[model samples]
Target: MESDDLSSLSEKKLKKLINETQDVLDQLKAELKQRKLDRQHHEIDHMEDYFEDAEHNLSNLRLFIQKVFSEIRKR
Candidate 1:
């Protein structure tokens, strides 16, 4: 959703969205951690690129989450 669309949501709905986004962020973090651990024990070709992509996506998600949070606080 766009920032404008998000800004239009009711406080209750916004809080729910925030919670859901947080859950997703948590899951991504766990997956990234696990991937790193697994890579350490096994030799996987081109695994570094996978990790880089995952980290990049995670960072974007985090920024989006932060924006949502800031919107919530504005209420």
Candidate 2:
């Protein structure tokens, strides 16, 4: 509302408007926080997947190296 319009408001009416505005602000803040948390959770999930893949690749490499060493020893 314009400054002139706000000046005409009664104290009780202004108080009610302020309370409603505060409530809406609080809800928006909560939604923003939840979105941030969800993004962080998604990032953590991706990291876990990367770690699991790396672990599997390392295990396979270890077995291959051991087999190559065994063949070298036999020769």
Candidate 3:
């Protein structure tokens, strides 16, 4: 969702969104950790690029969630 749309949400809704976003971030981190463990067993080939992409996206998601929380705090 756009920042404008996010800014328009009610405080309760915004808090809920922040919680959901955090959950997603946690899942992504868990997935990355599992991928690293699986790599030790050679379960996947050429996964470095995939992991890098995931990390980048996860960083962006974290920033977005931070922005949402910042907005919530401003209310």
Candidate 4:
């Protein structure tokens, strides 16, 4: 009889531990998804800034080329 009681208590403890581990796993999954989304947003913003810098550089180059052509024509 004592052995039977011990078996029942051990089973209950195992079930409780399983439930706690599942809850923790679920929370970790949620946090991981959120972090991925945040990283994607950051990458998008970084790309936009890079494009903007390239556009500004192109505009300056165009102006410089025009000035050089004008000077050549005058000469």
- TM per prediction: 0.53, 0.62, 0.51, 0.49
Please give, for residues 21-48, the per-residue lDDT of candidate 2 as tens digits.
9999999999999999999999887997
The true-versus-predicted C-alpha distance at residue 37 of model 1, in Å, is 0.2
Question: What would the per-residue lDDT of candidate 1 be over residues 23-66, giving only the tens digit for each residue?
Answer: 99999999999999888767567778778777688789999999
Q: Which candidate is the best by TM-score?
A: 2
The candidate 4 region of ten consecutive residues with least summed lDDT is: 1-10
Can you write out model 4's per-residue Cα lDDT over 13-34, one digit (the tens) per residue?
Answer: 8688779989999999999999
Lowest lDDT sum, 10 consecutive residues, model 2, at: 48-57
Better of 1 and 4 by TM-score: 1
Query: What do the candidate models score in CA lDDT, each in turn?
Result: 0.90, 0.94, 0.89, 0.87
Q: For every model in order, what is the number of clashing pairs? A: 0, 0, 0, 0
Q: Which stretches of candidate 4 lie over 4 Å from their true place?
A: 1-9, 50-75
lDDT of 2: 0.94
